[model samples]
Target: MTLEASVVHGDWEYQPVRLPRDVTRLNATAELGLRSRFGGWELARTLLYADGTRKVWLRRKLSRMREGAAV
Candidate 1:
């Protein structure tokens, strides 16, 4: 998966996820769950298009993270 992430606001970082029309609901939920389970990501926003494609945003708290430093 490609990551298109940036600091929007607050103490959180966000990633945008795109689910194609062919993906099933169960698969999508599992995918999101995996992100949360292993990547500390949470659902931030979602939009479902008329063509069945979905756009999802996932966010995780920064918690005092610093660039070039191990958390």
Candidate 2:
């Protein structure tokens, strides 16, 4: 079996003026983590307030098929 790996990223911004009052600023990171996990991604790194926004890095492996002549 051939294996392939890829990195995924998720980001969220906290806009005090545009976002709803019920939205917590700290929850941005948590939300990103949960969403990534739900998509079968593993958390690789957490960047808080990087460039004034929350950033998350995730990684996952997948199976790849090789093109070859059938025996």
Candidate 3:
């Protein structure tokens, strides 16, 4: 439940997504796909930990139309 700060690189914004070790592969894939399909988040990067945890970076285009609405 640790939320990290979002990063803005050029015209894209990146958010860190944590996949716990307990989640199954099928569930994870479906969930990520849902996020991409509905939230406009795309896979940017990923790091697999030794304990089977995942640290993923989801990126999307940055829009300045609203304040504090990029999360």
Tens digits of per-residue lDDT, candidate 2, 7-47, equal: 22233212121223344666654764564667555655544
Name the lDDT of candidate 3: 0.82
List clashing residue pairs in candidate 3: none
Q: What C-alpha lDDT, on a 0 to 100 scale, does residue 58 get in candidate 1? A: 95
Query: RMSDs, each prediction?
Result: 2.7, 12.0, 2.8
Taking all chains together, each candidate's TM-score versus the true structure is 0.80, 0.37, 0.79
Candidate models: Cα lDDT each: 0.81, 0.41, 0.82
lDDT per residue for candidate 1 within 1-71, as digits (tens), equals 33465555667778898888998999999989999999999999988999988889999887655433533
- Candidate 3 lDDT, 1-71, residue by residue in tens: 23368888888878888888997889878988998999889999988999999888999887776335644
Task: Highest TM-score: give the candidate number.
Answer: 1
Top lDDT prediction, candidate number: 3
Candidate rank order under TM-score: 1, 3, 2
List runs of model 1 lying over 4 Å from the truth. 1-3, 66-71
Return the candidate ranking by lDDT, descending: 3, 1, 2
Q: Model 3: residues >4 Å from true position, as ranges?
A: 1-3, 64-71
Of candidate 3, the 10-residue stretch with the lowest lDDT total is: 62-71
* Candidate 2, pairs of clashing residues: none
